[model samples]
Target: MRNKLILSVASLAAAVSLTACGASTTGSTSSAASSAASGEVAVVKVGANPVPHAKVLEYIDENLAKDAGIDLEITEFDDYQTPNIALSEGSIDANYYMHEPFFNDQVKTKGYKFEHGAGVHIEPYAAFSESYKTAEEIPEGATIAITNDPGNQPRALKMLETAGLLQNIEDDSAALTLTDEQNPKKLKFEENQPEILVQVAKDPKVDLAIINGNYILQAGMSTKDAVIVESTEDNPYANFLAWRTGEQTDATKKLDELLHSDEVKKFIEETWPNGDVIPAA
Candidate 1:
């Protein structure tokens, strides 16, 4: 079922109150805005992560898409795999959560016929823990929670490697299959969906949780609370809007244009002043 998105600050506030704070679904599977003149709006159903992806699209839906005669139906997903699956199976017109490398990995592994739009935003990953105040304060045998999705798993591991939590960083971008010797602290890693990275961070039992910046923002928190954050300097993981190969719909096209617009850029810059979510070049 498609849920319609109306134009208002209240709608945006609703999204922030829910997904920004780690609630599972937002606004009940939203439908794309439709054209009244033609008697039916082109519903470009898009799947995205809840925090910034859906919020950005909602901004476009309210401010930009109405003028462009484009309607965006945003479907929210938690994990990395399902959005691509929904896009591939014709459940949605496009998606806006992952970057080039993650998308390429999905295509190569699952052979999903998908292509990307313009670069949207960069949400760096970080290590957040309620167990320890500092990185050194973390006790041995601490339980760590990371995203289980193959696309984001390496990112979590890479962040850990950079924090000196894991040594002998032979391949930071490869599959995470570390031996006992590879991890010095002998920390127990608990794999989870990317959407719950923040949830894990909130768990008192878990020592540490590696969460994405967008979710952290949704949780009414910032990367400043994290022990270690992934560097944004020439970061390769630039999130973008994507659709099926050679099948960019008119609504998707307008959305792509509006996403790179000045208003959206300004919104991102002002919303995340601490460089949690940076607009991609």
Candidate 2:
């Protein structure tokens, strides 16, 4: 909400919902891949989430991008759908939000024309609780809130399975839905939008909430605060800069450099600690 271009996650969900029912933006969109004359610079319009994605880009925009002949015009979106829509419609040059699995799912399901640049960082999913000190302390019939979207549900479930709540997970497929057989603890599963999971910290009924890494930071908590944290080893969820396939300009390429720079790595480590945000290995 600090940025003028930022939209709240709730409003983003509602706006994307309306667009799904035949209200998408029209016309061919273009990436910011521009070329500048002498003593000038190329500007690349980027779409991102407000919490960390846009924040990261803002750092590059101020600290590193200008020296590389690239200027970033960051537009923040609270929800995941708008950046892709804007990218396909040429509203922005690129986006810096989703990891590979979710990004691939979106491309596969929505048939969007997009390609990623390079890996940036991983926002590992975690299981958090206010009442329970550890996973073993969770009571039977405890209610848990998880992401309902196919792109993230499986990840949340996988985290729970790791926390010893459920099992019999066939694969890491996002489409897998649980049943009584998978519910060993008999813990009630409540599926809701990802953004709402952050509210579980203030709610007593939500014994264990599977929250995304981004929202966890917004709530002023770290992965170390969670009852169980996701393993970072070979994590497939490293978020990166993305744009239309074959449309990456020189400026966008420079973005990849700035994103992977040592400075950015230090920024991430200093900005977040205790594995709250892990730079892609």
Candidate 3:
């Protein structure tokens, strides 16, 4: 009877232990299932400028991101330089404010291992003046304020060449610094930070100011208001999405697709009906 009691007690203990093990396995399986469900959503952090870049991303986050199983985290940068820095530093997953030339220059000069998607839109670089109503009215020897950045300086010079404001303009690469011979009008070029070109445009002393389209919009000025606007046809300055090379995920690709979607195109059209910003071809 003593042996029987001991055997029965041991059997009961074994049964309890087995039950506890089963419960633990079940709990783990349930938790894993929950985690798998949550993993379907991907969070993508992007840096952009305020005017159109952040606004466009804001539209996607509010309207489309949830359905695509993406959560867009947008950081707005007031300056042009910081977005790429943030992207390179891993502070942001991607950026959307730079055009092809600027992107290429940043990658080349800074050695950022970056890759870009198709052009999403074009903000035509434009020239604004407080004193002149038309490009033809820009006087000889006038002081024109332009961006000092290498990528955009060439663009501004090319536009001036097109307007017949400057002569003997070299190719984009060589036009960084103009010689006295290139200056038929003897126009003095005042190089300033791109963001402040709007103030230069507003200054009565400055004869002309060529400003980036994004900055134009931020200052509540329209491309239509400019005396001279860069042509959109065969334009190579379309801004697009960019990310670190080999680090691009499905979420970033989805965001790029969304940026070129019909809905986004329509949003840009209706938002800037005067052709301040055009969808890239």
Candidate 4:
């Protein structure tokens, strides 16, 4: 495992430095003009996953944030845990990678007061395989891979349950962390972290694996390759711009506008049609 300590510091420093530069560049001129015309400057720190989330924010930086008189500095995380830690410690002002249930879990474990800022896009989970061309083609008895992290495990398991390969444990609301669950396919399950789940998908021993949208994009797989992908409309976990509790109203508002601006919405639509990444909106 990588050292969380070093990454945290680097993330903190990167966020602070960029926003500071943005503020110094236009702080006075914007203040003197009308709120929009004056080019007022606000500095904000945000954490995100590497592919689409960070990439989406960078798109905002280019089109929306710069014009709105806000300077956003972003820090990227590969795993899910560290960004919330950075936000709780005051290292970053906000984070944009997770949904509500996951964020709630973070607060419970890490002991921080955090709140959802703005609803961003949804990243549907996808099921992929190397041995089989499609989900239905996989033989009855095959090995499947899932994320090892507690947070992702349940989600993957739930997808399998929905696919009818596994019978979920009765009454488990958080069905992702299934143990002793009946596997009808007699499928062998291997647990790996979310980021590495794709590698497992590539293995010949692996028949199918559940992976998130961003990882699918990272692996250069298209929707055609996915045997299953999360439905955008009913997915419970809509990614949000999360901030330290009480701070959700101010810079967060601007961040929200920037994220959901007309241009960002259009980009998501055109770039990922079929409602693959539906805006919370």
TM-scores, all models, native as reference? 0.78, 0.87, 0.84, 0.79
RMSD of each: 7.5, 4.1, 18.0, 5.8
What does candidate 3's lDDT look like per residue over 15-64, in tens digits?
Answer: 34432432111122223224335766576777788878888999999988
Question: Highest TM-score among the candidates is held by which one?
Answer: 2
Please list all clashing residue pairs in model 3, or write none if there are none. none
Across residues 174-209, which tens digit of lDDT does each residue of candidate 1 receive?
334687766878878888766677777778889999
Model 4 bad stretches (over 4 Å): 1-39, 169-182, 274-276
Residues 12-53, model 2: lDDT tens digits: 554455434422222122324436334347777777877677
Tens digit of lDDT per residue, candidate 4, span 106-151? 7776687988855678878888876666656767767777766555
Ranking by TM-score: 2, 3, 4, 1
Question: Candidates' lDDT values, in order?
Answer: 0.72, 0.76, 0.77, 0.66
Query: How far in Å is the alpha carbon of 219 misplaced in model 1?
Result: 2.8
Question: How many clashing pairs in candidate 3?
Answer: 0
Alpha-carbon shift of residue 228 in model 4 (angstroms): 1.9
Strongest candidate by lDDT: 3
- Error (Å) of candidate 2 at residue 2 is 9.0
Clash count, one per candidate? 7, 3, 0, 6
lDDT of the structure predicted as candidate 3 = 0.77
Q: Could you tell me which 10 consecutive residues in candidate 4 have the lowest summed lDDT? A: 1-10
